[model samples]
Structures are given as structure tokens and as C-alpha cells.
Target chain A: MVVLTVLSLAMWLLTVHDANFSRMGQLGLVSILGWTYFVGLVLVTMGFANELLRTPLRKTWLLVFVLLLALYIFGTGSAVEPIASLPDSYRHAGLLEFIFQNGYARPHYVADFSWPGAFSLGSVFVAFAGQTNALGFTRWFPFFIELLYLAPLIVIVRSIGVGRRAAWFGIALFYTTDWIEQDYFSPQALGYFYLLVIMAAVFATWRAKPSPLFAGLRKNLHFRMARSRRALQLSRLKERGADPSPGTEPTSLSVFDSWRPRLVSAAKARRPKLVSVFDSWRLKPNPPIFGTQVVIQRRYVHGRVASLFARLEGRDTTKSLNTVQTLGVLGLLVLIMFALAMSHELTPYALILMLAGCLISRHLGRPELLAVAVLLALGWLSLGASDYWLGHLSDIFGGFGQIGSTLTDNVANRIAGSSVHQFAVNIRIYIILGIYLLAGVGVLRRATDSRVLEVVAVAPFFLLVVSSYVGEGLLRVVLYALPFTSLLAASAILPQQSGLIRSWLPDFRIFRYGRSSHTVIWTLVFSIVLASALATTVARGGNDDYESFTKGELDAVNYVYNHVTPGATVGTISPYLPFNQRSVGSVYWVSLYTSGSPTIKEITTGLLQIHAQYVVLSQSQENWGEIVAGFPKGWESRVFLSLATHGFHVVAAWPTASVLQVDPKIAKKG
Target chain B: MSGFLVASAASLSTSPAELIVMVVDFLLLSIRACSGVLGLRLTSRDSRILTSATVFFVALFIVLVVVRFKSLG
Candidate 1:
């Protein structure tokens, strides 16, 4: 496995070295990636599959394979591209530069300024490193941030009560299915990391312990339900063939049984057991599970919480932190939550929803922890981000309950780009739906004592129903749910069938592959994961045709930034170039195709109207026009020609990027 | 909230709005501290004191947050 991993890494290095960014198509980097890249991916996939399918899972080999896979998925863009891929990353760097220079975030400049924790931290790093700006970090931020996510991800997977193999597979599946491109050099990425850390700490240190009052209520409810089931002859119907008819007496009620006999006897008597049902619930000794028996359980959580906990309680034997360690973890979690609240706008809300789900399913102890998170999030928004909400209250509350439109904006509007981009978008949607479908299967097949994972996996969807989060709500919610959803999806292939709810679906003994059932299952898992990884490779990098900038383009942007005075206006046909790394608030940026593509006359008129001093026309902006906005292939050239004829002149030009400045006489006339 | 305080101070600007934010923020910090202490599994006396502190500070925080909301409106 180690040798395979090393070979894969070497292959990746060769592929990146041989790759040419100039030949990228609308399908993005995957269009240009060579056979060596594919070979590297296959090697890593084979290594991981081998590690996962074997007994007594080798942790070291599995981790190496997983890290190699992460590198292939996340590091390729940074290595293959001449510069950072996204314009937003450069904008974030510009924000960090501003904060480092001024020691403050300039409110009213951009909404992100109001939540400046991430930029401030980046500023501190830049100052400490004696660097002028954060531009250098932007190139490899995705790879670094994804690696940071691995630690918490491991803790979360292990602590969730999925078997060891399922946990490991889930981690790998998470990397492959993570096509959501939010892991840039941005606040949301760091905020997400903080969220994962908090969840890991919670799952590692806490177990569900019901209050005395709730315990008594649950006990009485269970006893009454048992009586009712007996009265209805449900138990007799379920255990029809298992009757002790020969001459022997019935055994005692077994706590581990799907149906306890004490409750059964009480139901037969029908009076005193109903009376002692009011007695406090007591802990029963742990026992082994009966073979392959499906447990019929109530789905509603109101009265069934105790039995639910009883059935699932000992599955999570991983959490063994003593009181002091637990308390210390709680403190660290609160501090992280505070930082998260100050860093990003939406993640704190996501955390609150997830924590609430945990509290509901009894995965989290200390109810006050949830309240603290809520207060911290709300309090920070109301206070720290006051400038953002003071005048834009409608932006905060207007989208509430508009689920239909939110879906349209997030899903429908995204699928209308170029044919290639449309295909990528469709594959992204299918990948999400596929993971979710597998998770549904896992939920029905896996035996578990608690509903914590299900609750958490479903909880993030509520964020979508409430607000569109400026049209990225669906993406954010999917990201928040991906870890748990991946774990559940893994359970579809490797379910641990010995818990509270053994299996909702009846078994058909379909694993008739003779002694090769394990091989069959492993093959199914590998095929599914490899297919998803291939699809995700395209889906994740599909936008790179326009999003990834070239060195010439970066130099073009830097040339404009260095020449333009403060408060000067810079014009572009689209907002796809790497132009926002300097003079953020002082310089104004006007893009003609910001909302919609326009004619050459419109571009010329708009530039003259804004009295723009310099306009940058780059290959990326042209690609955006043709590929995304459906403009003519050479429209930018025509627009540049019209501008040059009217007032603009080419001051400097690169192979793929060019800068045009308005003639001084024409500017004076305007 | 501590992050907010440090960031706000580093900006070297303050106003009545900021003061109102500080009041609510301090109350939130107090509630958070009390909640943390209560989670420590302390002696009965300390637990009682912390519980009382949490409730009191939570109430104060709620009032201040509401007031600030009103002022913003």
C-alpha cells in the first residue's frame, strides 16, 4: 500500500508537470488531465479498497490511502493551475491585505467585512510571517484546509457508532463526494472546520443521559405500550412459532429482547404490572443480541425516547472521557463556537441546528451547551455584525419560508449554463441525490440504538426551508450534512446489524454469492466509490475553465492595479479575472456582464458612462462570456476593437491577457 | 464574544451603538461563563451559584438583545 501510494504521488507530480493550462476546455482541469493522473487516481483507489476490504483494518494504510485520495481531489487544481483558481480567493486575499494594512475591517465596503474574524487571523499570520499580503496562501488553501478537516472527520466517524470499516469507508467517501466548492481561502472554510471540531469534541466526550423525570416517564410509557401490544395480540403474532409449548415454564423478561417477558407477564395479568409501570426505570445488565431478529420500534420520539436510548445506549463505547477532560473539551468547544460566530455568517446557524439535533437525540449532554451556542451566535450577529443588518434587515428576513424560490435559485438557476457546464451541474445533482439515496438505504438496513446520526443528517435541510442563504443555502446545507450522510451511506454496504433497531427491512438472504459474499460487498463498495470519485473529479473542477486564472492574467491584473490611482475605476467585460487583489475599496470595478451579457455598443457605452480609466480583457473573461453567458466566440475581441476605435488604446498586452486604457482626450470629453 | 470585543477594540472606534452591543455582549459572555462553570460538575454550592448566575445573566442578555434590536429598528 505504501509503495502504491508513493507511485501515485509520483504519477501526480508527472501529470501536473506535463499538463498545460492553456488547453483547458469548458469541462475544466479534468479535460486537460492526462492518463498519468487517471493512473494515479486508480492506484490510490485500489490501495484504499484493499485496506478497507481486509479484516482487522490497517489504520496506517487506510489513512495513507485516504490522504493520497485527498491530494488527488483537492491538490490537483493548485498544482496544475498557474495561480489560484477562483476570483473569490483573490478577493479574500485583498481583504486580508486591507485588514493587515489598516488593522481593521472597513464596514459598508462589503458584507464580508462585517464578519472579519477570518481576515483578521490571516492578517496576523501575514504580519508574523513578514509577508506583504496573503496572495501566496490562496493557491494551496483548498488542499491545506481539507487536510485540516481530516482530524475532526476521523474523530466524528469513529465516535458515531458505525463499525470500524464503515467509519473508514465513510471518510473516503466524504472526500470523493465533496464536489461542493466552498473549501476556498475563505471564512466559510475555516468556519466549517471549527464546526467539525466542535462536533467531534461533543461526540467524543458526551453520551446521552436522561434526567430522572424523563426516565420515569419513558419507563411508564414503555410498560403501557407493552401492555397495549399484548392486548392487541401483536407479540403472539410476531412470535407465533417461538412459543414454549412442550411443558417448560416461560423465562424471565430479558432487557435485550425485542419484547421483554416481564412486560408480557404484566400484560397477561393486566393490573399490577400496569401499576408498577409508574415505577422509576432502572438500568438492566447488558446482554448479547439475539440472532438476526428485526426489532419493531416506534418512530415518534415523544414517549419512546427511553426505550430508544435503552436499545442503543452501549453502542457508543468510544466515549470514555472523565469529568475533567469532558469539562475541558466543553470549554474549548465554547471558545471555538465564539470564533465561528465571529468568522462567518451562516456556519454558526448551521452549528446551532446540528447541536439542536444532537440534543434532541440525546447525543449531547449539557443542554446549556446548546443554549450557549444559540446565544453566542445570535448575540454576535445582533452586535458584531450590526452594520450588516442595520440597513439590510430585509436581506436577512425577506427570504424566510420561501423554500420554492430558494430551490429554484440554488438548483434550477445553476443548471442553465453551457452544455458542458450543464452536464457537470447535472452530474453534481445526481451525485448528491445518489449519496442521499444510499444514506436512506443505510438508515433502513443498519442496526443502531440511537437516531443521532439520522437526526443530524436530516437537520441541515431545515436551513434550506428557512432561507436561501443568498442562493448558496442548498450548497451549505449539503456540506454540513455530507459527513454524517457519508457515514450512513457507508452503512448501506457494511451495516452493523446488532442494535436498537436491528433492521427495518426484512432480510431476503440475498447474499448467495456462496463464500464470496464479502468479496461481492467489497466490489460493490469499490465500484460505487470509484464511479463517484471520477464524476466528482469533473464536477469539482468543471468551472475551472473560467475560474482558474493564468500567470499572464495575474500579471495583467497586477499591472492595472499598480498603475491605477486610488478611487480610479477599472472596467471589465466580466468579473472572472484575478483583478481584486489590490485597491479593494479605493478602486471601483465595473463589469458589463455582471448580470447579463451585452452587445459591443453597450459595453462601449457603459465604459464611457463609468469613465473607466483602464479595462482588462483576459482569456478567462472571454471564456466566461462564451461558455457561461452564451456569448459569441470572439465577442471580446470585437468589443475591444470598438473600444479602441472610440477612445480606448491597448497600453500593454500578454499572450492571454491585455490591458486597455481610455485616451486622455476622450476621457476629458466624457 | 471575546473575539468580537478584541476586533472591535482593534478598530479603535466606538459609539452608542457599540456601547449597546457591548452591554448585550457582556451579558452573553457572563451567561457563557456561568454555563461553562455549571458544566464542570462542581460541588453543590458552586453548582447552585453558577446556575443562578446563568439564569440571571441569560435574562439580562435577553433584555439587552431585545433593546438593541429595538434601537436598530
Candidate 2:
């Protein structure tokens, strides 16, 4: 494992060294990344999968491999890029600089300042680090934030009560499939971090204790609903027949030979008729393992220190805490939730839904947590961030129950950039669908004590109904659900079919590889892990063509920022330039592509209309024009020529970017 | 009404009311959290007291928000 880790790390370093940002094509950073990167990714993924399959799982080794895989997937972009990949990252830095200089957020200046927790803290960090701006933090924030997610993700995967191997596999799968680019330098990233910690604390400290409210609700529905009636009858019949225990060894035979004898016996024991379709659709009784309390044992300081020195440690998934310690954790979670409420607009609502799901599934002990989350989120939106929605109430509430339009806008419209980009988008859709499919199988096929994971996994999808989050609602939903969904997906590959769906589906236990099964399970897992990682690499970097900036482009933008006066409008054909890192509110920006593909006359008219003092024509903007907007080749050059004819001239030029300033005389004439 | 709401939202930037509300809310939240640990059991009548206090605080918080909206109005 160590050798494989070292080899993969070395290969990653080589890939990073070999990468040239100048060569990045329409497909993004992956275009410039060579074979070494892919090879390294496969090596680390294979190592993690192999370790998971081994008995008495090596915790330290698996940790090393997973971290290595994280670096390969999340860190490579930062290491290879000349600057940060996204313009929003630098714009966030600009906001941080604003706070750093002013010592407070500019309320009502922008929507971001309305929820200013992340930027305010970032300002303090910048000052403490003796930096004037947050540009240093922007370059590698994705990698850093992902590493921060690991601690909470670990606790979450462990406390969900999946098998040790499946838990670890889920962690690996989560990192590999996390292609969503929200981990950039933003409030959403920090809010997501807080969300994960809250989930971990909740999962680790509490066990499902059935509430009378839900139980009574279930009882009323059981008598009132037809499906519930079938489910009740099926539950009674399943309870009467065959012992739903793992002790029943799986046999290698046809479906009839393996399952019929049990069905025949169950039929004889009960009525002599087979289960009807409605009965088969009903849920079977939960096995004893399903509802068992998962105790997360508390760790003492000395024990943690001792374990640090220990060479090999067994699985320590159970986090045990006494009442006082649990209270402390809960207090901290509340603080984090409050901060989350103040930081991001959407995460608090997502957290509220997730906590509601936990309450419904009986995973949470106290329902007050949900109430408090709702209050804080609503209070902040109404009181603290009133500046954001004061005149835009319709923008916030307009998309209510518009799930179909949200899907069309988020999914269908995004799939039309270019052939390569469309392929990346399609593969991303397929990967998400595949994960959800596997999660569905795991929910149906695996025996579990609690359905908390399934409930929490599906909870974030409700965010889709509110589509006003800049069209990124679906992405955020998938990201928030990925950790639990990944665990459920892992269970599909290694299902515990002890008491779950014994008759409706073929016994996957035959492939559990106790004695008769071969390497098929491992092969399936390996293939899925590798394919997901490869697909994620394509999807994650698919936008790099315009998202990533070169050193020359950054320099050109900095030159413009240094020279341009306040209140001046900067124009670009696309929002792909790495500007907006200074004079944020005073210096405005306009994108020409918002009105779709512009002719030379339209470009000239648009720039003149905005009175843009400086216009940036960069390689990334050119890439966006060609790839995403389907503009003709060298369209930017023709636009520049037309601009020159209208008295805009090149003030500065770089290898990959150029800046043009409109003459004051020409601007006045226009 | 929209103009009034916008003016009230704009006032939030200059007025210290929003800060005062947030600080007080945080203090109240701390109290609520600590009450759970200071020998108040959820199954006891004391829990009803806690629940009532929580409800009152929430109502007061909402009122404070409304006051922020209406104070300038």
C-alpha cells in the first residue's frame, strides 16, 4: 500500500509538472493533463479498493490511500493551473479584500455581502497572514476545502452503520464522484463544511428512538392506505416464515433451486399461495441488525494520543460520548448552524430539510434542532439578508413548484456547449443517475436497522422545487446528498441480503463471495470506482477552457485593475475573464454574450452603449466564444477590428490576453 | 409598501438594530442550549417550561425582525 501510494504521488507530481496551462483546450484542464495523471488516479483508486476488500481493514493504510486519491482528484487542478480555475473564486477574493480594507461588509452593495460570514472571517485571516488581499487563498481553495470535508465525512460514513468496508468505499466513492465545483472560494463551500460537521455530530451522538407521533401517523396510514394494508399483510407473512438471519448460508444454484425451497417452506408454514404483486411490493420486517443502536464511543485525549502511536488499530467507528460531552458537541453544532445560516442562503434551508428527514426517520433525538435551524435560517433571510430580497421577492418565490423548468434550465440547457463539453455533461448526468440507481438497489436489497440514511439521502432533492439559486440548485442538491448516497451505492455492490427482499429479487448473496463466489464482486467495485473517477475528471475540468486563466491573462487583468479608475465599466464578450478582483462595486462589468452571439456591429454598439472604458479580449474569452457560444473562429479579432474602427485601441497586450481602451473622444461621440 | 420595505432594508445598513438583534438572538440561543444541560429533563414538566421559553423567544425574534421592517416605516 505504501509503495502504491508513493508511486501514485510521484506520478501526480510528474503530471503536475508536465501540465501546461497554455495548451488547455475546449475541454478544460484535463486537455492538458497527460497519461501520468490518469494512471496515477487509477493506481490510487485500485489501492483503496484492494484495501477495502481485505479482511481486518488497515485503517492507517486506507486513510493514506484515500487522502492520496483526494489529492489526485481534487488537488491536481490547483497544482497544474497557473492561477485559480474559476472567476468566482477571484471575485470572492475581491469581496474578501473589500472587507479587509473596510473592516466590514458593504451591506446592500451585492447579494454576497448580505450573507457575509465567510468573507468577514477571510478578511481577518488575510490581515493575520499579513496579506493585502485573498489571492493567495484562491489558488488552492478547492483542494484545501476538500481536505477539510474529510474529517466530517469520515464521521458521517462511519455512523451511518454500513459495514466497515462499505463505509470506507463510500468515502472513496464520494471523493471520486464529487465533480461539483462548489468547493471554490465561496460561502457555499464554508456553509457545506459546517453542514457536514453538523451531520457528523448529529449522526455520531444520536440513535433512532421511535417517536409516538410518527408511530401513530404510521398506524393511521396503515389502516387508511391500500399500500400500507398490503405492506402490513406482507410484514406479518414475512415474520411468520423463514428465519431472516445471516446464518443461512447461500447456495450456488438456479433461482428456483436456491429460493424456491424456502418459499415452498414458507408457503407450507403459512397459506399454500404465492405472494401477490402488491404483497411483493410491500416492505418486509426489518431484521434485528436494522434497528440496533449504533453507539459512537467517545474518545479520550490519551486514547487518541495512544492510537496515534499505535502501528495498527482496529475499526473505531463507534463514537461514544457522555451527556456532558454530547451537550458540548450539540452546543458547537448550534454555533456552526448559526454561522451557516448567516453564511449561505441555500445551505440553511438544505440543512433544515435534512434535519427534518432525520427527525422523521427517528435518527434525531431532539426535534428542537430542526426548529432552531428553521428559525435561524428564516430570521437571517428576513432580518440580516433583507437587503438581498427586498425588491426581489419574486425572484426568490417565483420558482416555487417549478421543478420541470428547473430541470430543463439546469440540465438540458447546460448540455449544449460543444461536442466535448456535451459529452462531459452527458457523462455527469449518467454518473449521477447511476449512483441514484445503485442507491435505490441498496435501499431495496440491503438489510439495515434504520432507514435514516435513505431518508437523508433523498431529502436534498426537495431543494429542486426552489430553483432561484442561480440555476445551481440541482448541483447543490446532488452534492449535499452525495455522501449518504455514496454509502447506499456501496451497499448495492456488497448488499446484506439477510432479511431484505428475499423473494422479489435474485439473491445477491450468491455473489457475496463467502466460498462459491469468485472475484466478480471486487471486479465490479473496481470498475465502478475507476469509471466514476474517470468520468468525474472529465466533468470536473470540462469548463476549464474558459474557467481557468493563464499567468498572462491574470497579469492583464491586474494591469486593468491597477490602471482603471473607480465607477468605470469593463466589458468582455464572456464572463470568462479573471477580472473583478479589485474595485468590485465601483468598477462594474458587462458580458456581451448575455444577449447571445453578437455581430461586429452589435459588439461595437454594446461596448459603446455601456461606455466601457476598458475591454478585455483574452484567450479564455475567445475559448468561450468559440466553444460555448459557437462563435466563428477569430470572431474576437473581427470584433477588436470593428472596435478599433470605432476608436477603441489596444493599450496593452499579452501572449494570451489583451486590453483595449475606448478613446474618450469616440465615447463622447457615441 | 415595496418602497417602505426597501427603505427599511436600506436603513438596516446604517442602524445598529440588526447587530443588536443578532447579538441578543445569539445570547438567547446560548441560554436555550445551556438550559438543556442545567438539569432540565425533556420528559419532566420543566421541559414544558423550556419549550414555552423557546416558543416565546422565537416569537420575540420574529417580532424583532418585524420591528426592523416597521421601525423605519
Candidate 3:
């Protein structure tokens, strides 16, 4: 633990020293994170698990503090004070300022203003802080938001009936593997907090006791299957169910010979080699393994954890709620849902999907809660966000069902950068695939548990089948699914008690590699957690080199704000720079994506048309053009040269940015 | 009521994303209602019938939304 703390501080120091906005590399991380950081991480994971298992509540406060600081150091540590990793953070600050000064959302300025709850909240926060804008709070926003999530995370984990060790493992893994970067200051980030809080509150207040309907069904199925077993030579489950013991193994080869799966190994062997990496989780028919080493591997720990849940329940399990308490909780959920509906365009949908999953799984006791979420979300989609989607209806459905294209947009195109960036992308893809694979194993392996957590984990993927939000919907879905996936992944090694379905077990080849000892399994689980945590730490900051801006660029834009007239139209090749942080509505902010990706001629015409007085070009714009828009590398230089040569002249040039004054002859259009 | 449903369907730009959300929402509601019926937890046969009728309308809405989205696309 001490070593890990030192390493985290070291990484923070290095990032502060070396990170800047010149090179578009992996996650803007300076080159301080190396093998030593990973080694320290492995130690940390080992120590954390050991501490948790030995004493569930011992030193947990310290654990939370250390993990949060490490995550902050890895995510946005290099950033200048009051600024964050992405330019979007600054734009968010601008939106808050617009709301603060104007007192209402301004539609059509940005799609964000259309759903203005988060910005309004930020406005409120800044006013409370006696600050002009949210700029004073943006830098630590991600850290604070992530910290806010830890409490609800514990409650959600408790709902799964896991032990303290498994819950801690799940929480740690969630922080470790989360690379979606949505935790930054945005609507989705706050929406995420609301979603978690609502889920936790619902689980605590409304969870129903386990009923025996499935048990009766499983009993009937068991009787029918056992009667057919004599004729069919099926691996008889009578002994397994009656005994509830792992040592009672199969006596003969006849039981094993009788089991022929619907997905026969022969047919599975014929699958194309290219899908080998995903072969383990290839949506095939796989049944539970009873009385084999797997039963021994999984069921024994179940009894132990069964006792652990009483302790794991923390002070907040679901109990009988009176009318007043129920109403209070319901009101709170409604308020959060309304803010979420008005704040984010996508997370409301994600929340509805999860609630719908809970309803289908019978985990949700209140159907009205699900209805509330759906009505709120759909209502907002039809009203609050109509302006955004009405014009962008094509964008909403443009990438529908285009899995290959969406994957390419999210993954393939991003992999085509510098060697370091390519390596970082590969690592990211590997870690993502690896974690899902572990989660898939957990789902299949724990089939007897009704797979409630697994079902919730999968509920959001349906959103991807219809629309990809410029490839970001998939990322947000992944982000929203991360907590559930982390819980499911923890269950892979943390053996769980079987539900009624455990009686219908199939052949048990999957458990061939199971270990009988608890200590060994603990080691293996912690090792997996640590390795993933280390790789995620590296990948999170790999692109920090170019994505984050320096003080010089901010200073140049600050100079523009100090000098330029209030009504001046400021332009850029792309939406970069800190220009719009002040004068919200008075200054016209134009960029290529918002005004239709324009040609050089269109840019000149548009600049003259708007009578643009000030223009700023910075490194972040150059990086966006090169990486996202496929503007050939160094095209920014040619465009800037042309601008300087023609009408725009350099007024205040910083090392990382330039402020240009447009020719005075172009008169302002009416 | 059916005419009102038809009119509501006609008024909006039924993109694939919208259709999918509509379909998912209806299906989940139907599943929840069906769980209640199948569990023998519904108050009466009238409640069961109402749930079944909702399922019917949900299915109909899904088909209409899909067809509209397809034709538009």
C-alpha cells in the first residue's frame, strides 16, 4: 500500500512536469508511467484484496482515498488548474456561464444548451461558490464525480448478495477498467450519479424477497429429466441436489458419455479461426456444470458467502417502507430522473434500459418506478431535445444497426495514429475485450443465479442495435454498463450460491482447470484485478500529450476575451481554444462541424460574411482535424498561412496558439 | 383510440432510433405485465385480459413504428 501511494504521487508529479499539447499521442500522459508503476499496481491490488478479505470494514476509508487519488492522477493530473483533459470541459464552463448570465438555456448555440440541467446545476454551484463560471471547479470535477459514485456503488453491489471481498473487488475493478472518459464534467457524468443513486435507493427501499416460483418449476423439470435419464444416460443430478456436496463425483464413464450438447464440440471446433479470441463467449448454448470440479469450485464458497451477505448488507438493505418514506424516496427519484432527462441526451435512455431489465428480471418491485423513468425519458426526447434531433434526425439513425461501421468509428479509425498511440489503442481494445470476456464467463458460469446482474449489464447493448451517437453512444453504453459488468466479473472467481436452476446441470468440461484451495483462487482473482488496473492506468493517459492544452493557449484566448469587442465574431478551423468561456451570447462562435464542414473558400466567404473580427487557431484544433476529421496532417498550418496571407493577421501569437485580426474592410452583415 | 394512435404515429419523424426505443419500451412493459399474469399475482381475470390487450397494442405499435421507419429510411 505504501509503495502504491508513492508510485501514484510519482505518476502525478511526472504528468505535471511532462504533459502538454503539442503531440497527439496516447492520453496526454507524459512518459513517467512504466513497468514500475504496473508492479506497484499489482502490489496494491494484492494488498487491497488481502486487507478486504481479512477484515471487510478495516481501513476501507483509506482504501477509497488512495484509489481515488490514483484514478485522478491517471486521468486529469497533468491539466492546468481549473481546466480538464478535453476542450469540452471548457465549453461546458461556457455553457454554465451562458445559463448564469442569461438565466435560461439558449437553444441552437450548442446541442448541450438544449438539455441544460447539468449546466444549470453548474451555474447554481458557481453562484454558491461566488465564482463567475464553472471554470473554478472543472479540473477536479471528474475526481469529485467519481468519489460521489462510491457510496451508491456499494449499495448496488449489496443488492447482488455478494460478500464484502467480492463487493470490494467489484468496486475496485470498476475504477480500474473505466477508460470511457465520460466521468469528466458533462451531463452524462451527473446523469450517471443520478442513475446510480436512484438504483441504490430503489434497491434499498423496494427490493422484493426471493420467491419459490422458480424453485417449483425447477423441481418439475428435475423430476421429468430424471425419469428420462435412465433411458437417455444423462449425467444424473439427483445425487448433486440431494447431497449439496461437491465430493460426490460421478462413479462411471456412462454418465459422462450420455451428455451430448446441442452445440457439440465437433461443430464448435469448425468455427473460423479468426474468431478464436471471442470463441469462449460466442453466444453458444452452454449449461451449468453440476457435481463436477466446477460445483466444488463454485458451490462451496457459496455457503461461506451466504453467511457473508448478512454482514455485507451494510446499514441500507430494503425493508418495509411506510407511506411517507416511500413517497419521499419516490419524489427524490423523480427529481433526479427529471434533472437527468433534461441534462443528458443519452443517459436517460440508459437508465430506462436498466430499470426495464430490473422489471423483466422481477428484481424491480415497483413497476411505477420503471414507468416514471420511461415517461420522463421519452417525454424529454420528444420535447426538451426536439431541436437537437429534429434537424439531426439523420444523425440519430445514420449509424443504426451498423455494428461494423460503429466499431470502426470507435476503434479502427482511432488505431491509425503514432506508434505509441497505436500501441495504446491496442492495449485499450485488449483490456476492453478481456474484461468483457471475464464478464461473459461470469454470466455463463453463474447461470443458476438468475443472472440479474448480468442481465442488467446487457440491457443497454440493445441501444446500439438502432443508433450510434456518432459512435459515442456505444462508448456511453459501455460506461453505463461498467459497474454491472464489474460486479459480474467479480462473480467469475467469487463463487456464488446457486438458485433453483442448479438442478439441471450439463457436462462439466469448463471446470477442468478449477482449483480446490481458497487461497490460490484469491491470488488468481487479485492478480487479474491488478493486471487490468495497471493496463487501464497506462491507457487512460496515453493520449494526454495532445488532448490537453497548455497555459499559453489559454492565455492567448484569455487575451482575446480581454481585448476583443463584445459583439465580435470569433472563428476557428475547429471548435478549439478557451474563447467562449466569457461573453456567451454576444460573441458568435463558429466552427466547421457546427456550420457544416466548410472548404477554404467557404471559410473565407463565411468569415467575410460574418465580418469576423477575431480568430484563434490552436493545437487542440489541429489535433482534432488530423485525428477525427481526416484533415491531412499539417493542414492546419497551410490554412493558417493562407489566412495570414489573405485577410487575417496575427495579433497575439503564443507558442501553442495564434490570435488573428480579420481585415477591417469586411463590414458586419445585418 | 386506434385513430389517435395512428395519428400519433403519423405526426412524428419515425427514425430507426425512435422505433427501436419505442419497441424496447413496449416490450419491457409487456414483459413486466406478463410476469405478473404468469405468476398468478394479478388481481383478477379482468386484469389479465387488460395486460394481454396491452401486449397486443404494444406489438401493433412496434410493427407500425418499424414499418414506418423502414419506409422512411
Please identify model 2 stretches exceeding 4 Å from their true place. A210-320, A497-506, A513-515, B1-36, B40-73
For each candidate in the order shown, give its overall lDDT on alpha carbons. Answer: 0.77, 0.74, 0.63
lDDT of each residue in B1-73, candidate 3, tens digit only: 1212232354455344555555565555544434544464544355446545544544555465445444543
Which residue ranges in model 1 land beyond 4 Å of their true spot?
A209-319, A507-515, B1-3, B6-73
lDDT of 2 by residue, A410-461 (tens): 8887888668778878888988998989888877666665687888998999
Which segments of candidate 3 are over 4 A away from where they belong? A1-27, A30-43, A55-62, A65-82, A219-324, A398-404, A501-519, A565-568, A593-612, A622-639, A666-670, B1-73
Question: Between the candidate structures 2 and 3, which one is better when assessed by TM-score?
Answer: 2
Worst 10 residues of 2 chain A by lDDT: A291-300
Lowest lDDT 10-mer window, candidate 3 chain B?
B1-10
Ranking by TM-score: 1, 2, 3
lDDT by residue for model 1 (B1-73), tens:
2336664554335334434544554555444445445564455456446556655666666676666666664
Native A-B interface contacts kept, per candidate? 0.18, 0.08, 0.00
Better-scoring candidate (DockQ), 2 or 3: 2
By TM-score, the better pick of 1 and 3 is 1
Question: lDDT tens string, model 3, A1-670?
Answer: 5665566556554544453334435344535444444444555566666565563356654464336435544444534332466777877888889888878777566678768888888888889999888876777777788878888998887776555556777788788888677877788889899989988876666554443222333435445334333322233344234432454343422333433231133223222332242234323233343323333223224323432332222111244576456656766887888888888888888888888776655456555566657656765555456556665667777776788888777766676655666777788888778889887766655534445576789999888876777757667888888988887777566535455444223324333223344466667667787677767766776655555676788898788888888777777766656556777777777765532345666656665565667878887777665555556678777777777666778888887788888767534322
DockQ in order = 0.22, 0.14, 0.09
Error of 1 at A268 (Å): 26
Q: Which ten residues in a row have the lowest lDDT in candidate 3 chain A?
A: A307-316
